[model samples]
Target: MSKNYVLSLYNKMGKLPFGKKLFSLFASNKAPYFKTVSPLITKVVPSECHCLIKKRRKVENHIGTVHVIAIANGLEMAMGFMAEASIPTHLRWIPKGMDLQYTAKAGSDIRCVALLENNQWQVGDLPVEVTAYDENDVVVVKGIIHLWVSEKPKK
Candidate 1:
C-alpha cells in the first residue's frame, strides 16, 4: 500500500538539509492557527510526533515565560501530525476536545511530544496523550487531545 500522505511528505522532506523546518512551515501554513507557537516538527511517525518551540518573545507571556496558550498550540500541532501519520487509510480524525494542565513554569524552550498506542487508533473518542517539557526536562504541561475517529466518506 502507498504510504500515508503526511508520512510520505515527511519521509521525503525530512532527508534534505533544513527539511524539517520546511515541512513544519508547510504544515503551519496549512493550519494557520498553529503558527502562533512557531513549532518545529522534529519527528513524525506512526503513533508519535515530536516538536520543539523556542521560548521567544512572541510566544512568551508578560511574566517572560512561554505562555500556556503557546504550549497548547504546540501540543495540538504535535497531536495533529501524529494522528495523520498513525490513522488507518480507511479512517479519518478531527479534534473533539482538549484537557490540559500547566504543571510547571516553562522557563526555556519546550519540547512537545504526542503519543498514541497502536491499538488506540480505532474509532471512537481516542485520547492522544501529550506532554510538554522544559529544557531541563521537567514536565511543564500535560494533557489529552480528544479525537473523533470515523470511516472516511465515500468519494
Candidate 2:
C-alpha cells in the first residue's frame, strides 16, 4: 500500500532545519482556522501527533489565561494530523464530535498531544485521545475527539 500523503510529506520535510515549523505552516494554510492558535506542530508519527500553542495575547482570554477554544483548536489540529498519519490508506476519516474537559488554568505555553493506538484504525467510531499540558507539564485540558472512519469509495 502507498504511504499516506501527509505522512510522506512529514517524513520528507520533518528532517530539514525548521521543517516541523514549515510543515505546520503548510498544514495551517490548508486548514486556515487552525492558524488562529498559531499552532506549532512539533511531531507527527504513526498513531500520535504533538502540537504547541504559545500563551500569547492572541490565544489568551480576558482572565489572563489561554482560552479554552484556542486549546480546543490545537487539540483538533493534532487529532487531524494523527488521523492522517495513522489511518489505513484504504480508509477515510472525519471528525464526528469532540468532548473536552478544562482541567486547569493554562498560564503558560500549552503542548497538545493526540494519540491513537495502531489497532484502533478500523472502520468505526474511533476515539482519539487528546491532552493539553502547560509549560509545567500540568494537564490544562483533556478530551476525546471522535472520528467516523469508513472505507474509501471505489472510484
Clash count list over all predictions? 0, 0
Compared with the true structure, all predictions reach lDDT values of 0.93, 0.92
Q: What is the TM-score of each candidate against the true structure?
A: 0.96, 0.96
Model 2 lDDT vs. the true structure? 0.92
Itemize residue pairs with steric clashes in candidate 2: none
Question: How much RMSD separates candidate 2 from the native structure?
Answer: 1.0
lDDT of 1 by residue, 1-155 (tens): 56799999998999999999999999999899998888899999899999999999999999999999999999999999998888888888999999999999999999999999773677878999999999999999999999999999899
Runs in model 2 lying further than 4 Å from the true structure = none
By summed lDDT, the worst window of 10 consecutive residues in model 1 runs over 117-126
